[model samples]
Target: MYSFLENSTDIHIHCCPHINKRSTDIFEVIKFAEKNKMYAIGLMDNFSNTSGYASLVKKNFPNLNLKIFGGLIMEPPAGGVSYENAKISLEYSYFENDGAKFISFPTHHTRYIAIQEKRKLDYIQACFYVPDSGPTNETTKILELIANKNVVLNTGHLSPKETLTLVKAAKSLGVKKILVPSNNFNKTTIEKLKIHNVYFEFSYFFVSKATEVPLTHIDDESHKIKGLTLKTLKDLIEAADPKNVILSSDCGVSILPKPHLGFYQFIKQVHELGFTIEEIDYMIKTNSKRLFRI
Candidate 1:
């Protein structure tokens, strides 16, 4: 029988100095995972490629028994969804092993963030621009590239309409895995995502009342917005199949619970709300392992 900690693999962890002022560094994150006996952690550095760094760190710390994965967020910092950039990142691995396990679309620099925060239109740079017909030609090309690479695609802060279009196109192009950030998902699109086998992720960072990552570090105005309620999460879980659901700590802010504790609490709360252990395991562990291909 696997221990409780053995099952939880955190797919979202914001480390330091990547747009968001994260409390933990790559090394600290690994230490925490080792101490808690976690299987893996995905270093979600905003607008940066942390995959190579994470692989190097793991090599340096040969004694630690944790898998660290990293990827590029197709935001401005990552050269904004260019095919060449994506190819370089996707090919980056330890020797022949694929270290770049996940690839997310724009996060802070999305049109959705601009509208939500009332930022200037020029402030946000999107991975793909959509017109009345559908995603632009460039967007389609990028989707094809992503599909061929077969990396996990995270819908980072894209509006519901954009997410729907992107998911539909990505699936048709052969992108096997998709992940939608927690609050970004709504009832209208749940069933559609299920049809495509896209995974909807739930995180504790936004919901935790206690601010951990210090408001000073979070430059994005959306972080100031209130997080979704546990009830909302429950509804989302019930609405989707257990296999297509993923639970993670989008945790790393100094003000919130550490990754392990936040993840544990997320499970505890959902369980208290009547989510079965099997269901929780599938979301928190099984789905993430499959997504990260660990």
Candidate 2:
């Protein structure tokens, strides 16, 4: 209630340089992030397919002086949300069969796949199969890529098998920083993922307001809210190593009065539920930097 969201550092945010969502200008978003004491912001655009926006931030607000890490949300032949689609997007290098199986990320009608936690793999596979057959040896692709430390093989859309297999592949490959940043509803298997270097990313608004966002819905037919709930957050923190966990606002839906406000509330609630300050610090400061190589 007293704003535990203070001194927040958002590891992920898609802003003006990347997406012209127009909900708030990049300048204004930066101002808000600074006012909120957000230490680092990852500037990603689902389009443009490059980190070019990072340079724009440096050009405009050199004075603000934030780290401003840049990345793109890659899509496979299956889909593209933020221009993260590239043949090499999943592959680190052509020398080995390395890369990620982005699968079904951006939805058919909307932008990303919506799956019940139990059915995420089915949903993702359906997407990966879209416009073409899925990869033959996706596991090898994940392993070879993350093993080298040059790429972060995120589990975009796929089943639990994808998440688990990717983690194992990443581990076998030498990936120390794996991120399971699927839609919040994806039931992140903490133990299975923890065997490999990975952290589960829970979104802010999706958990708080289940019905509004496509990925966060809990309807039994299409998507089940599943892991996108308060108890899931608590359980993950309790069951897993805090250092291997991360939090994100998502802040995608247009209903927000202010961006990151709902995320602010989500993190605050997590803290109030007895998650250690040290753990929060690890997720907010250390983990993301280590994973993204920022």
Candidate 3:
């Protein structure tokens, strides 16, 4: 285990029992976190609620030292963005007297991106979206639930306009904890969003080319794949300011290394890029703790 990882937490990690292929299972991820003396890890699935699975793990592993949490992705498979689905997920996530810790808007199944990429999935009607006027009554109701529960809100794969609108609404609703993937928007948008105090999640997966997961439609030639190099990542962190950022592996695809190993390499590279240990820890450790309130 790397010294920098001591007491760290990764708020975004993909693991098995997923609709798509993954490199590791929940058990493998847990063992790796415990082995590295990590404080916590949040499990994310694009198509379902991982809160029930996380609850089961906690119930079965009573003596485990590390905290394991899970969240829901508001996509078609999870019942889309609705108050009912979020309520049910939270109810089902109960473990150790707490419910699900986070709730994300749609990622791959977002209406904006799905239409943009010309995806042919049958559940396109169920894809999540907010009107140009902003969140609808139902969406605002769900945001209220998220705020009342104090769960982290993740801006998943929405366009810059949609993300900004949603973030502004979530903040107004008293949703204190929010996370946005840094790669989803440009530096100017990121800097604009900084005023809301949302945590920017930086992942090494953006730089890694190996993945069995389909990031784009087969016929979408207009969409070219791009990734951030180490220097770009450094610039993004500096742009967002280290205090409001969190580092995640976003690993677990069949071809990528397991989350822990990939994360080790991520921090190592960030260190080599002239980020001080204190800065790295602030992003990977302190920000995570504050966001999740662990």
Candidate 4:
């Protein structure tokens, strides 16, 4: 294992039992994390809440050293941004064991992007969106729940404008930890969002060539997606303070490398790009520890 993998934390990763194909199952991911001496890993599934699965892992592996956490995504299949659903999901998490550490607003099914791309999926009966006015009553209630629980709030795949609005509202509501996916914002937006004290999550998948292909069976136009180069990722990092940045694999699709390998490669690439180990550790370990309160 590389020095960086020791005590490193990855807050974003996909696993099996997904609606789409994944390279590994949750158990495999957990085993790998433990063997690599990782600090923690968060499980993400777009169609359902993973809190229960994380609870199962914790129950079965009481002796393991690694921390395994799960979260909810506000897609149609996961109850679509309702306060009731969010509440139940948190309750299911059994937070004492590190379950439901995150509550992500919609990702691939974000209404803003779905409309922009003209995306149509059968399971997606509805898409989640926040109006220009701000979060709805239901959303406000969920935000309050998040603030109360003190879990991470990930701004998944929302349009940059919507993300900005959501972040402002979440901050005002006393939500301490907010996560924004890097692909959703540009340099200017990154600068703008960082000022609000929200962590920007940069995924290795975006820069890998494997992302040019469809990650799941339903994704047909992925080949048309433009992949971000290493230089661009470096530039994006420089756009914000290192303390506000997070590095995650965002890998698990069958088309991509396993999450751990991809994460190691990501760290290596960033280091080769002239980032000192201290700076890389700040993004990969220090900031992550702060976010997860490890």
Q: Which candidate's lDDT is highest?
A: 4
Query: RMSDs, each prediction?
Result: 2.6, 6.8, 3.0, 2.5
Candidate 4 residues lying further than 4 Å off, grouped into runs, are 94-98, 120-125, 217-226
lDDT of 1 by residue, 1-294 (tens): 645567479888876455544566777777778888898888887657778877787778877778888888877766676767777887676646565677777776676766666666566443244544666766777778778777788877777777888888888788887888856576767877777788888777766874323253225443354477778877887888667788888778766667777778877787887878888889888888888688
Tens digits of per-residue lDDT, candidate 2, 1-294, equal 434445555655544432223356566667777777666676544443334455556666768745554543444322343222434444332224323322223322221343333455555464442221233365445345445536555565445564565455456656655677644333356666666656766566456554544442212334434335577667766656677777776554344434567557767787877887777777666776676655
Estimate candidate 4's alpha-carbon lDDT, on a 0 to 1 scale.
Answer: 0.82
TM-score of 2: 0.70
- The stretch of ten residues in a row with the least summed lDDT in candidate 1 is 210-219
- The lDDT values for all models are 0.74, 0.52, 0.81, 0.82
Candidate 4 residues 106-160, lDDT tens each? Answer: 8777677666555776433367777899999999999999999999999888888
Error of 1 at 78 (Å): 2.6
Per-residue CA lDDT of candidate 3, range 108-152, in tens?
Answer: 777777776665676455577777889989889988999999988
Clashing pairs in 3: 23-252
Task: Estimate the TM-score for candidate 3.
Answer: 0.91
TM-score computed on alpha carbons, candidate 4:
0.92
Q: Estimate each model's TM-score.
A: 0.90, 0.70, 0.91, 0.92
In model 1, residue pairs whose N, Cα or C atoms come closer than 3 Å (at least 3 residues apart or on different chains), thus clashing, are 211-255, 212-254, 212-255, 212-256, 213-253, 213-254, 213-255
Which model is ahead, 1 or 3, in terms of TM-score? 3
Clashes of each: 7, 19, 1, 0
